[model samples]
Target: MPKIPECDRCRFYCGSHYLVCAVLPSGPDGKECHHFAPEPNAEPQELWEPQGARYIDDELVIERVTYNGEEIIQPPQRWSREKKLWLLDNHPMFTGLCPSCGAEFERDFTARVHWDCPECGWKDDSV
Candidate 1:
């Protein structure tokens, strides 16, 4: 009959066998069976370090570094006329203007789409 290893010396025979053990039996005394499991094809944990500002060269001298240099060209900003018109027509600040009294009114832009002029009580006119 094959003898089953005693639990007192077997590292694989833990109270809970939820995790698998890769360690082989050392000897009869089981002196090295203290949760000694070999990690097979396991990758090492990577530690992250914070990165700061980087420089190309340690000792680099600038001859003429102007704040507003002519060579420092900026790209022109792109705008849509149709979108601007739509925003102007739909915006609460512009659309809430009273036609009769010509007074600017405040309205909740997020809650409601329709706005009423506070001064003249006018309901519907595109500002």
Candidate 2:
């Protein structure tokens, strides 16, 4: 059988002809081209995500709100990059103290974002 490897992936592919490759008009020397390069603009793959979904730390976050037994999907509120970094550094769970007041306090489970300092009345404006 004739050696005709898939030319569509070759970087030298002219994109007009299905079998015609740029390296050799006829075909590869043997089963495949010795210097076959991948096409820079090959068929792009489509990426699909659920509405109101976002990626955080390479993980997708989707918010689904249900009311009256009906499922309602809403996108999670976007947090600024600075706010995220501040949380990672100064949040009581990580540092065990208010970034502004330096007073150690337990973090509220429901309110994990910006917090108020009980000792110095310092308001966290990062998040």
Candidate 3:
């Protein structure tokens, strides 16, 4: 009952649990079988896998990070959260009024970048 490795690639191999092959029912007698005929196509082939990946729960999972076909650039934050909150609450850019003279700025603040006050001559140096 010596099951030789040549049984998998042999032409007379009957893919079964009980039977080893058609030519030899209990497999080959020795390491090399005389009745062994090479089968071009073999069953139970190994699946091809990509590098830097592994099979997890029968699914292929990549280890490295993958991004879309676009250049990624992140600008540094100039001010802290407290400074931003202070600017939003008191600054003429967000309040639409000068902090020194209390003069009302232009209603359309979105279009304007420079928040300089014309009445009190308060220049916007924060931006």
Candidate 4:
């Protein structure tokens, strides 16, 4: 009697040299054994992860959004490398100076939401 792969993990396995399992003593007919029963003290299986996702440092890192009691997975948003560098170079909030008059804003310009320049009368409406 040849033992199948699932015979070792099945609870009904006889574990004897003469008999294979109590359910099917002569061994199962096919690979898909319907009478195969799992052991109660078996080790837990690995977690199932969806496509395009991965585990990092034993932690699952994925972007998920809940809508209408359903969870939707989506990729995280990020600015392009070139666009971020451009913002650091051109944007007044980072530059701390008016683009038109080139007048320097106060050191605490980041605290102020509005970037209106008093020198050139430049109104900041790009909110």
Candidate 5:
């Protein structure tokens, strides 16, 4: 048996160490197996700013909507490299850089959102 990467996104690990089994088959060696199939990982999704007010069952939701008719949702705010560097220097939870482009941005955990990198359009979802 080969070591496999721990997958924390599977639902099977609901209790008892929350142990996630290897998604890959073939004994976790990336080999071929009859049951070999990629397990669904709960990868986070990007949250984009909505364009309009949303209503459900004739009830209005105010958490994500604005008071006016316009949808003033949370959009990425632009910051200069200096600002990013400052954040990197000061913040404790900043993580990984985008390889597509060398732009940096902060992840807001409280909001569960991330601002898109100004230099490149990289988005972080696990903020």
Candidate 6:
């Protein structure tokens, strides 16, 4: 069995485990310390942890799962096929006005089969 170290009898010892003390936080390099003093109560110190950190019913709950070392999240929904088709017809990006000629529509003529201008050969990809 290993022998108890010198800091065990020191007054400033704050043994909460993982090598911690009030005066010698990381513990003394040698078995003996200059600031060694007897504890006021001189009772055996027991190791402990936070109330939430300890096991509840003999089962640990601190375990966690990750996605490639990162938390997994739900991705954003994609646009529907119908919405894409509607945007292609009415949206200005697909069809707006003739580029080669100065021919513009009064209202949105999205149902038109050919987007090419009648007066000019300007085309809008026939969208």
Clashes of 1: 0
For model 3, the stretches where C-alpha displacement exceeds 4 angstroms are 1-75
Model 2, span 13-92: residue lDDT tens? 65443445566766676776776777777863223565677544335668678889999877565676798887888776
Where is the poorest 10-residue window by lDDT in model 3? 69-78
Of the two candidates 5 and 6, the one with more favorable TM-score, higher being better, is: 6
lDDT of each: 0.43, 0.65, 0.74, 0.74, 0.43, 0.57
Who wins the TM-score comparison?
A: 3
Report the C-alpha lDDT of model 5 over 20-82, residue by residue, as the tens digit.
243432233453333333338555322233344334433433344455777565444466579
| Candidate 1 Cα misplacement greater than 4 A, ranges | 1-96, 125-127
Residue 101, model 3: Cα distance from true site in angstroms: 1.9
List runs of model 6 lying over 4 Å from the truth: 1-4, 46-127
TM-score of every model?
0.22, 0.31, 0.38, 0.32, 0.19, 0.30
lDDT of 6 by residue, 4-59 (tens): 46565667775545544676677766656777788767776443443334433344
Question: Candidate 4: global Cα-lDDT?
Answer: 0.74
RMSD of 3: 17.6
Rank the models by TM-score, top first: 3, 4, 2, 6, 1, 5
Clashing pairs in 4: none
Alpha carbon lDDT of residue 33, candidate 2?
78
**Model 1 C-alpha lDDT versus the unseen true structure:** 0.43
- Score candidate 4 by TM-score against the native: 0.32
